[model samples]
Target: MSFDKIRDPRKIRHQIGDMECDYIYTAGVAGERFYIALRDEEKLLATRCEKCNITFMPPRLYCDNCFTELASFMEVPSKGVIESYTITYFDRDGQALPEPEILAFVKIDKTDGGLIHRIGEIKPESLKIGSKVTAVFEAKKERKGALTDIKYFKPA
Candidate 1:
Protein backbone atom coordinates (compact mmCIF):
# COMPACT_ATOMS: atom_id res chain seq x y z
CA MET A 1 0.00 0.00 0.00
CA SER A 2 1.16 3.51 -0.78
CA PHE A 3 0.48 6.52 1.52
CA ASP A 4 0.95 9.64 -0.51
CA LYS A 5 -1.25 12.64 -1.39
CA ILE A 6 -1.82 13.69 -4.98
CA ARG A 7 1.36 15.05 -6.55
CA ASP A 8 -0.38 16.83 -9.43
CA PRO A 9 -1.17 20.55 -9.72
CA ARG A 10 -4.09 19.70 -12.02
CA LYS A 11 -6.11 18.27 -9.14
CA ILE A 12 -8.33 20.77 -7.32
CA ARG A 13 -8.02 18.87 -4.06
CA HIS A 14 -4.39 17.92 -3.60
CA GLN A 15 -5.09 15.96 -0.41
CA ILE A 16 -7.75 13.68 1.01
CA GLY A 17 -8.88 12.89 4.53
CA ASP A 18 -11.48 10.74 6.30
CA MET A 19 -14.49 12.67 4.89
CA GLU A 20 -12.81 13.83 1.72
CA CYS A 21 -14.57 13.03 -1.54
CA ASP A 22 -14.49 14.07 -5.19
CA TYR A 23 -17.03 16.81 -4.80
CA ILE A 24 -17.26 20.50 -4.04
CA TYR A 25 -19.29 21.53 -1.04
CA THR A 26 -20.65 24.98 -0.49
CA ALA A 27 -23.51 26.72 1.32
CA GLY A 28 -26.00 29.28 0.08
CA VAL A 29 -26.47 32.61 1.81
CA ALA A 30 -27.65 32.36 5.41
CA GLY A 31 -30.82 34.40 5.51
CA GLU A 32 -30.78 37.41 7.82
CA ARG A 33 -34.18 36.65 9.31
CA PHE A 34 -32.91 33.38 10.79
CA TYR A 35 -30.15 35.11 12.74
CA ILE A 36 -31.68 38.46 13.60
CA ALA A 37 -32.19 37.39 17.20
CA LEU A 38 -28.71 35.99 17.46
CA ARG A 39 -26.49 38.48 15.64
CA ASP A 40 -28.39 41.69 15.00
CA GLU A 41 -30.35 41.11 18.23
CA GLU A 42 -27.50 39.85 20.37
CA LYS A 43 -29.40 36.80 21.61
CA LEU A 44 -29.70 33.04 20.98
CA LEU A 45 -32.27 31.16 18.89
CA ALA A 46 -33.52 27.63 19.55
CA THR A 47 -36.50 25.87 18.14
CA ARG A 48 -39.15 24.22 20.26
CA CYS A 49 -40.94 21.17 18.94
CA GLU A 50 -44.64 21.75 18.59
CA LYS A 51 -45.27 18.11 19.41
CA CYS A 52 -43.05 17.56 22.47
CA ASN A 53 -42.19 21.12 23.51
CA ILE A 54 -38.48 20.33 23.47
CA THR A 55 -36.30 23.42 23.08
CA PHE A 56 -32.90 23.34 21.51
CA MET A 57 -30.22 26.00 21.35
CA PRO A 58 -28.56 27.06 18.13
CA PRO A 59 -31.98 26.28 16.76
CA ARG A 60 -32.55 23.33 14.52
CA LEU A 61 -35.20 22.65 11.92
CA TYR A 62 -36.31 19.48 13.68
CA CYS A 63 -36.36 18.03 17.17
CA ASP A 64 -33.92 15.28 17.92
CA ASN A 65 -36.30 13.28 20.11
CA CYS A 66 -39.74 13.79 18.58
CA PHE A 67 -38.75 14.30 14.96
CA THR A 68 -41.21 17.15 14.95
CA GLU A 69 -40.63 20.41 13.19
CA LEU A 70 -38.91 22.75 15.60
CA ALA A 71 -40.57 26.00 14.57
CA SER A 72 -40.85 27.94 17.78
CA PHE A 73 -37.66 29.94 17.99
CA MET A 74 -36.82 31.43 21.34
CA GLU A 75 -34.21 33.90 22.45
CA VAL A 76 -31.50 32.60 24.72
CA PRO A 77 -29.16 34.85 26.67
CA SER A 78 -25.40 34.89 26.13
CA LYS A 79 -24.33 33.20 29.29
CA GLY A 80 -23.23 29.71 30.21
CA VAL A 81 -20.57 27.45 31.68
CA ILE A 82 -17.39 26.22 30.08
CA GLU A 83 -18.33 22.57 30.27
CA SER A 84 -15.16 21.43 28.56
CA TYR A 85 -12.21 22.78 26.60
CA THR A 86 -8.89 22.05 24.95
CA ILE A 87 -5.84 24.14 24.19
CA THR A 88 -5.44 24.01 20.43
CA TYR A 89 -2.19 24.46 18.60
CA PHE A 90 -3.52 23.60 15.18
CA ASP A 91 -5.65 25.19 12.49
CA ARG A 92 -8.71 23.81 10.71
CA ASP A 93 -6.33 21.94 8.39
CA GLY A 94 -4.46 20.55 11.42
CA GLN A 95 -1.38 22.68 10.96
CA ALA A 96 0.12 24.43 13.98
CA LEU A 97 -1.41 27.87 14.50
CA PRO A 98 0.95 30.78 14.89
CA GLU A 99 -0.17 31.04 18.49
CA PRO A 100 -1.81 28.45 20.69
CA GLU A 101 -5.60 28.62 20.80
CA ILE A 102 -8.18 27.95 23.51
CA LEU A 103 -11.33 26.21 22.33
CA ALA A 104 -14.12 25.70 24.82
CA PHE A 105 -17.45 23.92 24.82
CA VAL A 106 -19.87 26.38 26.36
CA LYS A 107 -23.22 25.05 27.39
CA ILE A 108 -25.66 27.72 26.25
CA ASP A 109 -27.31 29.56 29.11
CA LYS A 110 -30.56 27.64 28.76
CA THR A 111 -30.27 24.91 26.15
CA ASP A 112 -29.30 21.32 25.37
CA GLY A 113 -26.40 21.50 22.91
CA GLY A 114 -23.34 23.57 23.78
CA LEU A 115 -21.88 26.36 21.68
CA ILE A 116 -18.27 26.01 20.61
CA HIS A 117 -16.34 29.30 20.68
CA ARG A 118 -12.89 30.51 21.35
CA ILE A 119 -12.42 31.42 25.00
CA GLY A 120 -10.72 34.78 25.17
CA GLU A 121 -8.97 36.60 28.02
CA ILE A 122 -7.79 33.39 29.74
CA LYS A 123 -4.56 31.80 28.70
CA PRO A 124 -4.40 28.18 27.58
CA GLU A 125 -2.76 27.24 30.89
CA SER A 126 -5.24 29.23 32.95
CA LEU A 127 -8.58 28.01 31.58
CA LYS A 128 -10.68 26.27 34.20
CA ILE A 129 -12.71 23.25 33.18
CA GLY A 130 -15.97 24.44 34.70
CA SER A 131 -15.51 28.18 34.59
CA LYS A 132 -18.25 30.56 33.50
CA VAL A 133 -18.22 32.46 30.21
CA THR A 134 -20.48 34.86 28.34
CA ALA A 135 -20.92 35.73 24.70
CA VAL A 136 -19.59 39.03 23.43
CA PHE A 137 -20.65 40.46 20.10
CA GLU A 138 -19.24 43.05 17.81
CA ALA A 139 -21.02 46.32 17.02
CA LYS A 140 -24.27 46.07 15.07
CA LYS A 141 -22.90 47.77 11.98
CA GLU A 142 -20.20 45.13 11.80
CA ARG A 143 -22.47 42.21 12.53
CA LYS A 144 -22.83 39.33 10.08
CA GLY A 145 -24.67 36.00 10.03
CA ALA A 146 -21.55 34.05 10.88
CA LEU A 147 -20.59 32.82 14.36
CA THR A 148 -17.81 35.40 14.63
CA ASP A 149 -20.53 38.03 14.77
CA ILE A 150 -20.34 37.16 18.43
CA LYS A 151 -16.88 37.76 19.71
CA TYR A 152 -15.02 35.24 21.82
CA PHE A 153 -16.38 34.28 25.20
CA LYS A 154 -15.08 36.14 28.22
CA PRO A 155 -15.36 35.86 31.99
CA ALA A 156 -18.90 36.75 32.99
Candidate 2:
Protein backbone atom coordinates (compact mmCIF):
# COMPACT_ATOMS: atom_id res chain seq x y z
CA MET A 1 0.00 0.00 0.00
CA SER A 2 1.27 3.46 -0.96
CA PHE A 3 0.59 6.26 1.58
CA ASP A 4 2.31 9.15 -0.18
CA LYS A 5 -0.63 10.63 -2.11
CA ILE A 6 -3.16 12.49 0.02
CA ARG A 7 -5.64 14.34 -2.18
CA ASP A 8 -8.63 14.69 0.12
CA PRO A 9 -8.55 16.28 3.60
CA ARG A 10 -11.65 14.33 4.67
CA LYS A 11 -9.84 11.02 4.01
CA ILE A 12 -7.33 11.66 6.80
CA ARG A 13 -8.04 10.40 10.32
CA HIS A 14 -6.39 11.66 13.47
CA GLN A 15 -6.61 11.63 17.26
CA ILE A 16 -5.98 14.71 19.39
CA GLY A 17 -4.88 14.10 23.00
CA ASP A 18 -1.94 14.43 25.30
CA MET A 19 0.48 11.50 25.27
CA GLU A 20 2.25 11.26 28.63
CA CYS A 21 5.59 9.57 29.15
CA ASP A 22 8.52 9.70 31.56
CA TYR A 23 12.18 9.55 30.57
CA ILE A 24 15.66 10.19 31.98
CA TYR A 25 18.28 12.15 30.05
CA THR A 26 22.01 12.01 30.58
CA ALA A 27 24.66 14.40 29.22
CA GLY A 28 27.21 12.14 27.58
CA VAL A 29 31.00 12.24 28.06
CA ALA A 30 31.73 15.61 26.44
CA GLY A 31 28.78 17.35 28.04
CA GLU A 32 29.58 15.79 31.41
CA ARG A 33 33.07 17.29 31.39
CA PHE A 34 31.83 20.65 30.14
CA TYR A 35 29.21 20.94 32.86
CA ILE A 36 31.62 19.80 35.52
CA ALA A 37 34.06 22.56 34.66
CA LEU A 38 31.31 25.15 34.71
CA ARG A 39 29.98 23.92 38.06
CA ASP A 40 33.28 23.22 39.81
CA GLU A 41 35.73 25.77 38.46
CA GLU A 42 33.35 28.36 36.99
CA LYS A 43 35.28 27.99 33.75
CA LEU A 44 34.46 27.68 30.05
CA LEU A 45 35.59 24.61 28.09
CA ALA A 46 35.97 24.06 24.34
CA THR A 47 36.88 21.07 22.23
CA ARG A 48 39.44 21.33 19.45
CA CYS A 49 39.46 19.35 16.20
CA GLU A 50 43.06 19.02 15.15
CA LYS A 51 42.14 17.82 11.70
CA CYS A 52 39.95 20.81 10.96
CA ASN A 53 41.72 23.19 13.36
CA ILE A 54 38.38 24.26 14.73
CA THR A 55 37.50 24.89 18.34
CA PHE A 56 33.93 24.45 19.47
CA MET A 57 32.59 25.92 22.66
CA PRO A 58 30.07 23.91 24.71
CA PRO A 59 32.46 21.17 23.71
CA ARG A 60 31.47 18.28 21.49
CA LEU A 61 32.75 14.69 21.48
CA TYR A 62 33.36 14.70 17.72
CA CYS A 63 34.15 17.23 15.06
CA ASP A 64 31.11 18.33 13.09
CA ASN A 65 33.15 19.01 9.97
CA CYS A 66 35.31 15.87 9.78
CA PHE A 67 33.79 13.48 12.34
CA THR A 68 37.12 13.30 14.16
CA GLU A 69 37.07 12.34 17.81
CA LEU A 70 37.63 15.54 19.80
CA ALA A 71 39.88 14.36 22.60
CA SER A 72 41.65 17.68 23.16
CA PHE A 73 39.91 20.15 25.44
CA MET A 74 40.93 23.64 26.40
CA GLU A 75 39.78 26.37 28.74
CA VAL A 76 38.51 29.46 26.96
CA PRO A 77 38.10 32.89 28.46
CA SER A 78 34.67 33.65 29.90
CA LYS A 79 34.52 36.79 27.81
CA GLY A 80 32.85 37.02 24.40
CA VAL A 81 31.38 39.40 21.84
CA ILE A 82 27.66 39.77 21.29
CA GLU A 83 26.99 38.52 17.77
CA SER A 84 23.22 38.91 17.94
CA TYR A 85 20.46 39.72 20.43
CA THR A 86 16.78 40.12 21.15
CA ILE A 87 14.64 41.89 23.73
CA THR A 88 11.56 40.16 25.07
CA TYR A 89 8.94 41.91 27.16
CA PHE A 90 7.04 38.75 28.06
CA ASP A 91 8.05 35.60 29.83
CA ARG A 92 7.93 32.13 28.31
CA ASP A 93 4.34 31.71 29.55
CA GLY A 94 3.26 34.83 27.62
CA GLN A 95 2.90 36.80 30.83
CA ALA A 96 4.29 40.33 30.96
CA LEU A 97 7.50 40.77 32.87
CA PRO A 98 8.37 43.67 35.15
CA GLU A 99 11.32 44.42 32.92
CA PRO A 100 12.27 43.22 29.46
CA GLU A 101 15.18 40.86 29.22
CA ILE A 102 17.89 40.96 26.57
CA LEU A 103 19.04 37.64 25.20
CA ALA A 104 22.11 37.35 23.00
CA PHE A 105 24.30 34.91 21.13
CA VAL A 106 27.78 35.58 22.44
CA LYS A 107 30.69 34.42 20.33
CA ILE A 108 33.34 33.21 22.72
CA ASP A 109 36.88 34.32 21.95
CA LYS A 110 39.21 31.83 20.28
CA THR A 111 36.39 29.40 19.55
CA ASP A 112 34.21 28.75 16.52
CA GLY A 113 31.04 28.18 18.54
CA GLY A 114 29.15 30.46 20.88
CA LEU A 115 26.43 30.26 23.56
CA ILE A 116 23.00 31.80 23.64
CA HIS A 117 22.43 33.43 27.03
CA ARG A 118 20.71 36.32 28.68
CA ILE A 119 22.54 39.64 28.56
CA GLY A 120 22.11 41.68 31.74
CA GLU A 121 23.51 44.67 33.67
CA ILE A 122 22.70 47.00 30.80
CA LYS A 123 19.75 48.48 29.03
CA PRO A 124 18.55 47.00 25.74
CA GLU A 125 19.05 50.30 23.98
CA SER A 126 22.73 50.19 24.81
CA LEU A 127 23.39 46.70 23.48
CA LYS A 128 25.22 46.34 20.16
CA ILE A 129 26.36 43.48 17.93
CA GLY A 130 29.98 43.84 18.92
CA SER A 131 29.54 44.56 22.60
CA LYS A 132 31.93 42.72 24.89
CA VAL A 133 30.39 40.57 27.60
CA THR A 134 31.53 38.29 30.37
CA ALA A 135 29.84 35.30 31.90
CA VAL A 136 28.56 35.86 35.42
CA PHE A 137 28.54 32.56 37.27
CA GLU A 138 26.30 31.71 40.17
CA ALA A 139 27.79 31.54 43.63
CA LYS A 140 30.00 28.52 44.31
CA LYS A 141 27.50 26.76 46.54
CA GLU A 142 24.63 27.40 44.15
CA ARG A 143 26.12 25.82 41.02
CA LYS A 144 24.60 22.50 39.84
CA GLY A 145 26.55 21.44 36.74
CA ALA A 146 24.18 23.04 34.25
CA LEU A 147 24.11 25.90 31.77
CA THR A 148 22.26 27.87 34.41
CA ASP A 149 25.47 27.80 36.41
CA ILE A 150 26.25 30.99 34.50
CA LYS A 151 23.41 33.20 35.59
CA TYR A 152 23.85 35.58 32.67
CA PHE A 153 26.34 37.43 30.51
CA LYS A 154 27.01 40.99 31.54
CA PRO A 155 28.81 43.86 29.84
CA ALA A 156 32.54 43.54 30.32
Candidate 3:
Protein backbone atom coordinates (compact mmCIF):
# COMPACT_ATOMS: atom_id res chain seq x y z
CA MET A 1 0.00 0.00 0.00
CA SER A 2 3.00 2.26 0.38
CA PHE A 3 4.55 3.81 -2.78
CA ASP A 4 7.89 4.00 -0.92
CA LYS A 5 8.27 0.19 -1.13
CA ILE A 6 7.54 0.13 -4.94
CA ARG A 7 10.45 0.34 -7.37
CA ASP A 8 8.78 0.29 -10.83
CA PRO A 9 5.05 0.99 -10.66
CA ARG A 10 4.84 0.81 -14.47
CA LYS A 11 5.77 -2.91 -14.34
CA ILE A 12 2.60 -3.88 -12.44
CA ARG A 13 0.40 -6.55 -14.12
CA HIS A 14 -2.75 -5.41 -15.91
CA GLN A 15 -5.64 -7.57 -17.13
CA ILE A 16 -6.91 -7.39 -20.73
CA GLY A 17 -10.08 -8.98 -22.13
CA ASP A 18 -12.95 -8.57 -24.53
CA MET A 19 -16.60 -7.93 -23.53
CA GLU A 20 -19.79 -8.41 -25.55
CA CYS A 21 -23.48 -7.79 -24.90
CA ASP A 22 -26.87 -8.46 -26.51
CA TYR A 23 -30.27 -6.98 -25.78
CA ILE A 24 -33.68 -5.87 -27.07
CA TYR A 25 -34.89 -2.26 -27.07
CA THR A 26 -38.34 -0.78 -26.78
CA ALA A 27 -38.40 2.05 -29.35
CA GLY A 28 -40.73 4.07 -27.12
CA VAL A 29 -44.27 5.22 -27.96
CA ALA A 30 -43.70 7.26 -31.12
CA GLY A 31 -40.83 5.29 -32.64
CA GLU A 32 -42.62 1.95 -32.28
CA ARG A 33 -45.64 3.25 -34.21
CA PHE A 34 -43.50 4.90 -36.92
CA TYR A 35 -41.42 1.75 -37.47
CA ILE A 36 -44.52 -0.45 -37.52
CA ALA A 37 -46.02 1.69 -40.29
CA LEU A 38 -42.90 1.24 -42.38
CA ARG A 39 -42.76 -2.51 -41.83
CA ASP A 40 -46.41 -3.39 -42.24
CA GLU A 41 -47.78 -0.71 -44.57
CA GLU A 42 -44.71 0.44 -46.50
CA LYS A 43 -45.53 3.92 -45.31
CA LEU A 44 -43.78 6.66 -43.35
CA LEU A 45 -45.43 8.18 -40.28
CA ALA A 46 -44.85 11.37 -38.31
CA THR A 47 -46.05 12.77 -35.02
CA ARG A 48 -47.97 16.03 -35.04
CA CYS A 49 -47.98 18.05 -31.86
CA GLU A 50 -51.32 19.81 -31.49
CA LYS A 51 -50.05 22.42 -29.07
CA CYS A 52 -47.04 23.43 -31.14
CA ASN A 53 -48.45 22.74 -34.63
CA ILE A 54 -45.35 20.90 -35.70
CA THR A 55 -44.76 17.52 -37.35
CA PHE A 56 -41.70 15.41 -36.56
CA MET A 57 -40.27 12.78 -38.85
CA PRO A 58 -39.00 9.53 -37.28
CA PRO A 59 -41.50 10.79 -34.76
CA ARG A 60 -40.65 11.80 -31.23
CA LEU A 61 -42.92 11.52 -28.20
CA TYR A 62 -42.72 15.21 -27.43
CA CYS A 63 -42.55 18.50 -29.28
CA ASP A 64 -39.19 20.27 -29.36
CA ASN A 65 -40.80 23.68 -29.51
CA CYS A 66 -43.45 23.64 -26.77
CA PHE A 67 -42.52 20.46 -24.90
CA THR A 68 -46.00 19.05 -25.45
CA GLU A 69 -46.76 15.35 -25.75
CA LEU A 70 -47.28 14.53 -29.44
CA ALA A 71 -50.02 11.93 -29.89
CA SER A 72 -51.41 12.38 -33.38
CA PHE A 73 -49.75 10.16 -35.97
CA MET A 74 -50.03 10.91 -39.67
CA GLU A 75 -48.76 9.26 -42.82
CA VAL A 76 -46.02 11.32 -44.41
CA PRO A 77 -45.27 11.41 -48.12
CA SER A 78 -42.49 9.12 -49.36
CA LYS A 79 -41.32 11.89 -51.71
CA GLY A 80 -39.07 14.71 -50.62
CA VAL A 81 -36.41 17.20 -51.69
CA ILE A 82 -32.69 16.88 -51.04
CA GLU A 83 -31.59 19.69 -48.75
CA SER A 84 -27.95 18.64 -48.50
CA TYR A 85 -25.73 15.68 -49.40
CA THR A 86 -22.33 14.04 -49.37
CA ILE A 87 -20.54 11.18 -51.11
CA THR A 88 -18.58 9.19 -48.55
CA TYR A 89 -15.70 7.13 -49.91
CA PHE A 90 -14.60 5.54 -46.64
CA ASP A 91 -16.22 3.22 -44.15
CA ARG A 92 -16.46 3.79 -40.42
CA ASP A 93 -13.20 1.87 -39.84
CA GLY A 94 -11.41 4.30 -42.21
CA GLN A 95 -11.08 1.65 -44.91
CA ALA A 96 -11.96 2.69 -48.48
CA LEU A 97 -15.33 1.45 -49.63
CA PRO A 98 -15.71 -0.42 -52.88
CA GLU A 99 -18.00 2.38 -54.07
CA PRO A 100 -18.77 5.81 -52.65
CA GLU A 101 -22.04 6.08 -50.77
CA ILE A 102 -24.34 9.04 -51.33
CA LEU A 103 -26.11 10.31 -48.24
CA ALA A 104 -28.50 13.25 -47.86
CA PHE A 105 -30.95 15.11 -45.70
CA VAL A 106 -34.32 14.81 -47.37
CA LYS A 107 -37.00 17.28 -46.38
CA ILE A 108 -40.35 15.60 -46.69
CA ASP A 109 -42.92 17.83 -48.33
CA LYS A 110 -44.97 19.83 -45.81
CA THR A 111 -43.16 18.28 -42.83
CA ASP A 112 -41.05 20.15 -40.26
CA GLY A 113 -38.49 17.40 -39.88
CA GLY A 114 -36.39 15.46 -42.38
CA LEU A 115 -34.75 12.03 -42.69
CA ILE A 116 -31.07 11.41 -43.37
CA HIS A 117 -30.80 8.38 -45.66
CA ARG A 118 -28.75 7.00 -48.50
CA ILE A 119 -29.34 8.31 -52.01
CA GLY A 120 -29.28 5.78 -54.82
CA GLU A 121 -29.93 5.18 -58.54
CA ILE A 122 -27.94 8.23 -59.57
CA LYS A 123 -24.35 9.30 -59.85
CA PRO A 124 -22.94 11.38 -56.98
CA GLU A 125 -21.95 14.27 -59.23
CA SER A 126 -25.48 14.40 -60.62
CA LEU A 127 -27.14 14.71 -57.21
CA LYS A 128 -28.49 18.21 -56.81
CA ILE A 129 -29.79 20.33 -54.00
CA GLY A 130 -33.59 20.69 -54.11
CA SER A 131 -33.81 17.62 -56.34
CA LYS A 132 -36.94 15.50 -55.98
CA VAL A 133 -36.52 12.01 -54.55
CA THR A 134 -38.75 9.19 -53.35
CA ALA A 135 -38.26 6.43 -50.87
CA VAL A 136 -38.10 2.93 -52.36
CA PHE A 137 -39.26 0.34 -49.85
CA GLU A 138 -38.25 -3.28 -49.63
CA ALA A 139 -40.91 -5.81 -50.65
CA LYS A 140 -43.63 -5.91 -48.00
CA LYS A 141 -42.85 -9.44 -46.91
CA GLU A 142 -39.14 -8.75 -46.57
CA ARG A 143 -39.34 -5.68 -44.39
CA LYS A 144 -38.21 -5.77 -40.76
CA GLY A 145 -39.44 -3.09 -38.34
CA ALA A 146 -36.53 -0.78 -39.04
CA LEU A 147 -35.37 2.16 -41.18
CA THR A 148 -33.81 -0.22 -43.67
CA ASP A 149 -37.38 -1.12 -44.61
CA ILE A 150 -36.92 1.68 -47.13
CA LYS A 151 -34.02 0.40 -49.21
CA TYR A 152 -33.00 3.89 -50.33
CA PHE A 153 -34.16 7.20 -51.75
CA LYS A 154 -33.99 7.49 -55.51
CA PRO A 155 -34.76 10.20 -58.04
CA ALA A 156 -38.47 10.72 -58.31
Candidate 4:
Protein backbone atom coordinates (compact mmCIF):
# COMPACT_ATOMS: atom_id res chain seq x y z
CA MET A 1 0.00 0.00 0.00
CA SER A 2 0.98 3.72 0.38
CA PHE A 3 1.44 6.09 3.23
CA ASP A 4 -0.73 9.18 3.24
CA LYS A 5 2.44 11.26 3.45
CA ILE A 6 5.99 10.50 4.33
CA ARG A 7 6.51 9.81 7.97
CA ASP A 8 8.99 12.00 9.85
CA PRO A 9 12.28 10.27 10.69
CA ARG A 10 12.69 12.41 13.77
CA LYS A 11 9.54 11.02 15.32
CA ILE A 12 10.45 7.45 14.40
CA ARG A 13 13.93 7.89 15.75
CA HIS A 14 12.38 7.95 19.17
CA GLN A 15 11.39 4.32 18.62
CA ILE A 16 14.48 3.30 16.70
CA GLY A 17 18.10 4.27 17.09
CA ASP A 18 18.70 7.47 15.16
CA MET A 19 22.17 6.50 14.02
CA GLU A 20 21.71 2.79 13.78
CA CYS A 21 22.01 0.61 10.71
CA ASP A 22 19.13 -1.62 9.71
CA TYR A 23 20.85 -4.94 9.59
CA ILE A 24 19.54 -6.98 6.68
CA TYR A 25 20.05 -10.68 6.01
CA THR A 26 18.51 -12.47 3.03
CA ALA A 27 19.19 -15.22 0.54
CA GLY A 28 19.78 -14.28 -3.08
CA VAL A 29 20.35 -15.92 -6.42
CA ALA A 30 24.06 -16.44 -7.09
CA GLY A 31 24.80 -14.52 -3.90
CA GLU A 32 28.27 -16.02 -3.64
CA ARG A 33 29.43 -14.47 -6.93
CA PHE A 34 27.89 -11.09 -6.20
CA TYR A 35 29.55 -10.90 -2.79
CA ILE A 36 32.90 -10.65 -4.53
CA ALA A 37 31.94 -7.34 -6.09
CA LEU A 38 29.96 -6.17 -3.09
CA ARG A 39 32.17 -6.85 -0.08
CA ASP A 40 35.62 -8.09 -1.01
CA GLU A 41 35.77 -5.47 -3.73
CA GLU A 42 33.78 -2.28 -3.80
CA LYS A 43 32.42 -2.69 -7.29
CA LEU A 44 29.09 -2.48 -9.05
CA LEU A 45 28.55 -5.29 -11.53
CA ALA A 46 25.84 -6.86 -13.64
CA THR A 47 25.53 -10.12 -15.47
CA ARG A 48 25.65 -9.42 -19.19
CA CYS A 49 23.55 -11.51 -21.54
CA GLU A 50 26.03 -12.19 -24.30
CA LYS A 51 23.31 -13.07 -26.77
CA CYS A 52 20.78 -10.29 -26.16
CA ASN A 53 22.94 -7.33 -25.13
CA ILE A 54 21.03 -7.06 -21.86
CA THR A 55 22.48 -6.77 -18.38
CA PHE A 56 20.98 -7.75 -15.07
CA MET A 57 21.96 -5.80 -12.00
CA PRO A 58 22.17 -7.66 -8.72
CA PRO A 59 23.68 -9.91 -11.33
CA ARG A 60 21.93 -13.03 -12.48
CA LEU A 61 23.39 -16.34 -13.53
CA TYR A 62 20.70 -16.90 -16.12
CA CYS A 63 18.90 -14.41 -18.33
CA ASP A 64 15.09 -14.56 -18.23
CA ASN A 65 14.92 -12.34 -21.29
CA CYS A 66 16.28 -15.06 -23.52
CA PHE A 67 16.47 -17.86 -20.93
CA THR A 68 20.17 -18.41 -21.52
CA GLU A 69 22.71 -19.15 -18.86
CA LEU A 70 24.76 -15.96 -18.49
CA ALA A 71 28.41 -16.48 -17.77
CA SER A 72 30.17 -13.10 -18.12
CA PHE A 73 30.03 -10.01 -15.93
CA MET A 74 30.03 -6.29 -16.64
CA GLU A 75 31.40 -3.89 -14.08
CA VAL A 76 29.32 -0.72 -13.88
CA PRO A 77 28.65 2.23 -11.60
CA SER A 78 27.09 2.10 -8.15
CA LYS A 79 25.71 5.54 -8.78
CA GLY A 80 22.23 6.22 -10.11
CA VAL A 81 19.03 8.23 -9.76
CA ILE A 82 15.75 6.98 -8.33
CA GLU A 83 13.61 5.70 -11.20
CA SER A 84 10.73 5.25 -8.77
CA TYR A 85 10.49 4.80 -5.01
CA THR A 86 8.34 4.03 -2.05
CA ILE A 87 8.84 4.68 1.64
CA THR A 88 8.45 1.43 3.55
CA TYR A 89 8.20 0.71 7.25
CA PHE A 90 8.34 -3.05 7.31
CA ASP A 91 11.03 -5.51 8.07
CA ARG A 92 11.51 -8.84 6.29
CA ASP A 93 9.18 -10.49 8.78
CA GLY A 94 6.45 -8.12 7.59
CA GLN A 95 6.68 -6.26 10.86
CA ALA A 96 6.89 -2.52 10.29
CA LEU A 97 10.46 -1.41 9.82
CA PRO A 98 11.52 1.64 11.68
CA GLU A 99 9.23 3.99 9.75
CA PRO A 100 10.54 5.96 6.76
CA GLU A 101 12.96 3.46 5.27
CA ILE A 102 12.96 4.05 1.52
CA LEU A 103 12.58 1.16 -0.90
CA ALA A 104 13.65 2.36 -4.32
CA PHE A 105 14.16 1.12 -7.83
CA VAL A 106 17.60 2.72 -8.13
CA LYS A 107 18.60 2.94 -11.78
CA ILE A 108 22.35 2.42 -11.73
CA ASP A 109 24.27 4.90 -13.82
CA LYS A 110 25.90 3.94 -17.16
CA THR A 111 23.90 0.74 -17.67
CA ASP A 112 20.40 -0.67 -17.95
CA GLY A 113 20.50 -2.09 -14.42
CA GLY A 114 19.65 -1.23 -10.86
CA LEU A 115 19.83 -2.32 -7.20
CA ILE A 116 17.12 -2.06 -4.60
CA HIS A 117 18.63 -0.92 -1.32
CA ARG A 118 17.86 1.35 1.55
CA ILE A 119 18.13 5.10 1.07
CA GLY A 120 19.54 6.82 4.10
CA GLU A 121 20.26 10.40 5.25
CA ILE A 122 17.23 12.02 3.67
CA LYS A 123 13.67 12.75 4.56
CA PRO A 124 11.07 10.67 2.76
CA GLU A 125 9.35 13.74 1.35
CA SER A 126 12.56 15.18 -0.02
CA LEU A 127 13.09 12.14 -2.26
CA LYS A 128 11.76 12.45 -5.78
CA ILE A 129 11.55 10.54 -9.04
CA GLY A 130 15.04 11.43 -10.19
CA SER A 131 16.98 12.25 -7.01
CA LYS A 132 20.66 11.44 -7.40
CA VAL A 133 22.22 8.99 -4.96
CA THR A 134 25.41 7.03 -4.42
CA ALA A 135 26.24 3.73 -2.83
CA VAL A 136 27.68 3.69 0.68
CA PHE A 137 29.38 0.44 1.44
CA GLU A 138 30.60 -1.12 4.63
CA ALA A 139 34.36 -1.52 5.03
CA LYS A 140 35.45 -4.55 3.03
CA LYS A 141 37.57 -6.04 5.79
CA GLU A 142 34.41 -6.45 7.86
CA ARG A 143 32.03 -7.58 5.13
CA LYS A 144 30.58 -11.09 5.43
CA GLY A 145 28.80 -11.68 2.12
CA ALA A 146 25.48 -10.13 2.98
CA LEU A 147 23.27 -7.15 2.07
CA THR A 148 24.73 -5.36 5.08
CA ASP A 149 27.93 -5.30 3.06
CA ILE A 150 26.71 -2.16 1.34
CA LYS A 151 25.20 -0.11 4.13
CA TYR A 152 22.91 2.01 1.98
CA PHE A 153 22.82 4.98 -0.38
CA LYS A 154 22.48 8.60 0.62
CA PRO A 155 22.72 12.09 -0.91
CA ALA A 156 25.68 11.97 -3.23
- Total backbone clashes of candidate 2, pairs 3 or more residues apart or in separate chains: 0
Cα TM-score of candidate 4: 0.69
Give per-residue CA lDDT, model 1, range 29-139, as digits (tens).
Answer: 223434666666787776666567556766777777877655456777788899999887888898999988888899987677678998887777778878889988888
Question: Per-prediction count of colliding residue pairs?
Answer: 0, 0, 0, 2
Instruction: Give the Cα error of residue 8 in candidate 4, in Å.
Output: 39
- Rank by TM-score, descending? 2, 3, 1, 4
C-alpha lDDT of residue 145 in model 1: 63
Q: What's the TM-score of every candidate structure?
A: 0.72, 0.87, 0.86, 0.69
What is the RMSD, in Å, between candidate 3 and the native fold over all Cα?
A: 4.5
Range of the 10 consecutive residues with the lowest summed lDDT in candidate 2: 7-16
* Candidate 3 regions with alpha-carbon error over 4 angstroms: 1-12
Q: How far in Å is the alpha carbon of 35 misplaced in model 4?
A: 1.1
TM-score of 2: 0.87
The worst-scoring run of ten residues by lDDT in candidate 3 lies at 9-18
Q: Best candidate, lDDT-wise?
A: 2
Candidate 1 at 125: error in angstroms?
Answer: 2.3
Can you give the lDDT of residue 45 in candidate 2?
Answer: 93
Q: Per-residue lDDT tens digits of candidate 2, residues 11-87?
A: 77865578899987899999999999999998999999877989989899999899988887899999899999999
Q: What is the C-alpha lDDT of each candidate?
A: 0.75, 0.92, 0.89, 0.79
Stronger candidate by lDDT (3 vs 4)? 3
Number of clashing pairs, model 4? 2
